[model samples]
Target: MAAVPALPVSLSGRFKGSFAYFTIKDRLPQILTRVIDTLHRHKNEFFEEHGEKGVEAEKRAISFLSKLRNELQTDKPVTPLEDELPDAALWNQYLDYQRNLPNGNGEPSWFQSPWLYVECYMYRRIHAALAQNPPIDNFDVFKEGKAQNFFESQEAVIALCTYFQELLKNIKDLDEKQLQEELFKLLQVSLWGNKCDLSFSAGEDSSQKSSPLQSLENMVPYILVNDMEKVWSLLVNAKKNRTERSNVRVDIILDNAGFELVSDLVLADFLLSSKLADEVYFHGKSIPWYVSDTTKHDFNWTIKQLGSANHMWMSRCGINWEGNLKKGVWVFHDHMFWTLPHDFSSMSEVASDLYAELQKSNLLLFKGDLNYRKLTGDRKWEYSVPFHQALNKFHPAPLCSLRTLKSDTQVGLKPGQGEQIQASESEWMGELIFILRHLIELQ
Candidate 1:
């Protein structure tokens, strides 16, 4: 793919006299102030631990963040300049889109550009925040706490793996109808897990704790399961039909860790038990990503969670889940494919590799908010645009996006549904949940 264009020179003027002024004047400054404070708090500790090199790196990071904040505030519009990474291209695209929009009344700033732009900008700002802060600057604030928790719970990881192995032992005994019901239960558990993710909201009351699996319980029944069932039958009925050899693999683009991973493991186990897929491949982020992304250690920690005798659900499932792991029917991988920017250009560049890996799978299940944002190219689409159209042919496998909308950019809404949502709810675009399934052949 050719290089993306630079940010337009007109963006500064576009925001200067408009209501969107908060983005520059208040929001950006507030973010910068917090960043600087975070940096100052950790500076001494970072220096003491790493010596001169750490101190110098922290200083340079702080300087860059300060300069970037100043650039945002300046009267002179800054056009895009090349950066060391392709992620910069997303910001450049945002600037271009925002500058070119026809000014009109009642347009929201969040809807003025593609979803990818705002999501990428948030990530960049988070990166800036870390850079400006010392010891914390060197660490990913999102992942550090989670990683620490995983390391401290080694026993939990082993037990979960053992449970999965045992679950596999009972697969041959389940009838088709029983298998379907079991799979639906697991899907419900996976859907509910989205509620636990912190990105959605910071609790207003310190004492209130949100259920991690709430959304799943709400969304599972709404899933128009005719399609999901058809897909399931296609995989499971292959032997009886005898028309072709069935060698199906299901890929789960994993989301959070802890309970979320446990829910996903439950779903994976069901898929194998139902004969919906012979094997399951879990794809995880390569970097410390969106708070609870699964690392190698987290993967092990999740397995342990599933096998523990004290885990009420696992004990009740009455299957030896651990046997599946030992048989190599379940596998885990962390790949760089996830770390790249969400754009058509980036998707196209990586298509060949993605296709190669996914060619072996019958279905790819992308979970949670960030994965959904990336899959849709994070662009603000006309509410009527078909979900497949927004994907821009990036489907490497027949895919199901099970997401609780945390950001905008939804497609496939029924006529007037979008408008009705806007009228009734202040933040419907980000609060609604969806299970958008697209078959490669359907496109």
Candidate 2:
């Protein structure tokens, strides 16, 4: 078989005066300021937790974050990561790749490098700051916002949990068509959940403000390309094709916390209870990222929150979700590569272990915009570019990107459709959805 080629990574230069550039120059600095202020506000708590040493560490982290912000503002070249984390080497190696790109000058700067690289570097640099400060090293600077977002969506969380619990009780009695309808419904719920990201909202509230389950049907018109049938067919047909469908695995590349995380769990629970998947694995970030992207801490905290909520059905769902973990049917995994800025196409070369593990799954569902960006390589493709082309070499298994359009770059649109939407709707991109199907096919 021929080796698959990697897709082009979006450069900040190509899209100057675009969202990508604005993010690096203005928005990123604002985010860094919040992070620095967050550390300062927590200084007293750190001191209480780790004494004077913790206070000193907080100051150090703050100092490091402040400097990082300045570098972005001034277009300073991105330096090699100074961390002991195993993935730091992969990151630095990728930096070398960027530095050697056709550009004349050697060093990769925020304004000159791939948007994905520099954006991801921002988060890793944040971790490096805290990592350099021992006492507060393990503390997530974004935890408070995550917690607040989750609590703010309490009503939506309860409604969705209640719906899932009800579905579980009657799932056995549900006919194939009813099950399919519910599956598609929940999937759409999960898709819309992508909008609940704080990073896209610039550190403001972006939680689901209403009952997601109730509004699922009404949002159907917004899905520009719907291949829910293909996805469902992939699962059911895979069942028929197999001799025995015992170890069917579905990997969910998870997105945000709060209601978005809850939506993912609800979908996971449905997949399990409906027997669409026998085992489910969730991939989360290793560190705080994109404001609300799920970290291991966020993943575990969401389950615990659900398990201990005052609402009966939500609490029940949480306990059972946790039990799935105990029974080894549901698993949570965190890999440094997910947090890295590299395109998914580079996984085999950069994080072969993660790529190989993904190949074991029957299906992989990537949620939210950043994962979507990485999957599509965040490149400028013709609107009608085949989604598989955008995927490049990332066909590890049967995979579907269940993402809402948040970023400017998107693929898999029909001819002239992109131009039409660009003209008609100001926020047309975010308001639409598209799904393409590929199943366990490797070239």
Candidate 3:
């Protein structure tokens, strides 16, 4: 197994005034409060369904969550997960690993541990709280927020679907140059769609309000790294080199649910319609995650909502997506490996099956900030570090990350570019970046 990179220290809340600190100190507690409020607000609904047991379950869950919030605010030590789910033992083992790290800070706590590990641990604990409460074990505390995001982004969804449908009508008539341009446009639409992240805004309403297609040109300057040309070249060359019996598979590790999901779907549709890829695989979370990350439920719900919509173009697009899934032209997968707190570097050792599966793809597209952080190990790397090095020998295939910076860690930039932006803009981290890196030879 490859060693974890000894680069810089992992990004943690220990750095005062940093984004990690702000997230732990302010954003996280706000999210916890919202979860507690949601449980309390739904007490009457629980009573209607499961009667006394449901109401009792709801009360107990709320009490657990309230106590969880207090622990975080008080900087209490991170505790072991008690739920007997398949991943629970692993979670407890990870806690023990954190506690015994060389040069450790005694026991891992909310504000003193690695931001990625502790943040993930908090969500797992939230699940455990409800999981132990029986009648409510299956309930999703984040469901309401995810559904609201989908409903609120209706206008943007309609606009994107309409534009995509029109583009498909004449796709075959376009020249290679025109095809490349269209690919670039769709990729950017998917990239900027990341702005709808609810976690970034602390469970607030972060849906898209305007036309996503119209805003692409305006957002171009915000991309610190643009690798569209290389991505296009790689796809085109793969097509040229393929035999009639061979297939080019593209895997998209998805991100936020609402407008962002629609954007990713549109890009996948374009890939199939343009013959750039024969099949597209979408990977989502098995559990509710990061406030807005897509899960299997959210994926099917969005498709169903789109298919049953009143608008013609939107409904047609949804029906087409449904057909793609049925025909195996599109596939959706949720691996437990995604929800675990380990970095990609640990995948070969901890989740070898998933790592092997990714090795089959011709191209991998990882969407949003959290995926980017995982790709780069959520560490403090120098600005000009090469993209492949930041990956820490975790390459399974040629991959691209369509991420909008919403965190403190970023890599694969020019010498002074990251510093230049940081000095001038307090919110510079909230911009888009398109990165392509190939650490291993293509299969």
Candidate 4:
């Protein structure tokens, strides 16, 4: 067994009362209830599609989800998955790893293990239950909520698409100054769009309040550590130093499903139309995850939804996006590795193929809080620890984590910056702090 590094910040600490504890105690069960509840409402549809056998599968799936909920609420042992997914063995192996921890009773329990591990395990367990039962195996319990959330961001979607239309129309006319301004604006839009995360609000639609592109100046003060200039330089240097702009590739490891997705698409569109990247690759989850992580369904659905919307600019944006896919300007990929619980630092060893594929990109953008956690290994590092050290040599390509703070694990702050931010304790308007690998700090 790999020597487990310093014990992670577990949800069930000695006293059993951190946010992680609260999540397992309250939030996670609530999410499962909604999953089962959605199944209940769709019971007849399952019967309609799969006959009596489908009905039986639906009942079994619901029961499994309910029982899963019970184990979490009561803090029972996390049952290792029994399945055929390639990564299933790895999951089971980690369960064994946790089982042998100093305080473990030769078993992994919900509240006692690393919060990130067990929390991720719950979702994979749900997938396993469904995979074992047919017809329902393809059903996403969260599909309804995801689609509704997408529609709910209609106004912001229109405004953003309209902004894309305006800026992209004059792309060739813009000088470097104008080009950087547009890229920076869209980066903030993509970063702040993360605030609308459904998982953070426990599946509620957190809509964009006003025009995302119009709000950047007001958002300046909220960014605690801005490495965007360095990011810009990387892109600019790649464009100038490379033989052709089209050779540069930008890979975005996406997050969320609603407005956040739209923001990512808009930025991707800019990268392509402005020639910052020859091709844009988007990575999404292969299964339902963290309530709102992008999956193949969510990615296709958002693009089709935008392309076919009633509004003009919105529809045009969608149509253009469709054309981009058809022409191969934008490529989409989903790897099982994404849904696995391993921190990115384990990428080269555990998911070497993905690690190698990422090396092809000129730059990689990891979006939102969960991705940020995986990037930093979710350790309880002293805030001033240099960011590269926290990455533990996970660099497959030059990368950036554009995340809003939603979890307790953070690093790369200047001296005392962490405590100062904690003392204010104010609800955020919205914020985006990009943590770079300090090893790549621009001279």
Best by lDDT: 3
Q: Provide C-alpha RMSD values for all models, in order.
A: 7.3, 2.3, 2.1, 3.1
Candidate 1 regions exceeding 4 Å error are: 1-115, 121-138, 145-172, 202-227, 237-246, 295-327, 344-346, 436-443
Off by over 4 Å in 4: 1-15, 101-106, 244-246, 426-443
> What lDDT tens digits, residue by residue, belong to model 3 across residues 196-313?
9998898999989888788778778777788888889889988898899889889999999999999999999999999999999999999989999999999999999999999999
Per-candidate TM-score against the hidden true structure: 0.68, 0.94, 0.96, 0.93
lDDT of 4 by residue, 182-282 (tens): 88888888888888777777776677757877777887777767787787888888888788334889999999988899999999999989888878999
lDDT for predicted candidate 1 compared with the true structure: 0.57
How far residue 238's Cα lies from its native spot in candidate 3, in Å, is 1.4
For candidate 1, the 10 contiguous residues with the lowest summed lDDT are 202-211
By TM-score rank, best first, the candidates go 3, 2, 4, 1
For 271-342, candidate 1 gives per-residue lDDT tens digits of 776667788999886555555567666677555544554755554442345667678898888765575444
Clashes per model (N, Cα, C within 3 A)? 33, 1, 0, 1
Ranking of all candidate structures by their lDDT, best first? 3, 2, 4, 1
lDDT-wise, the better of 1 and 3 is 3
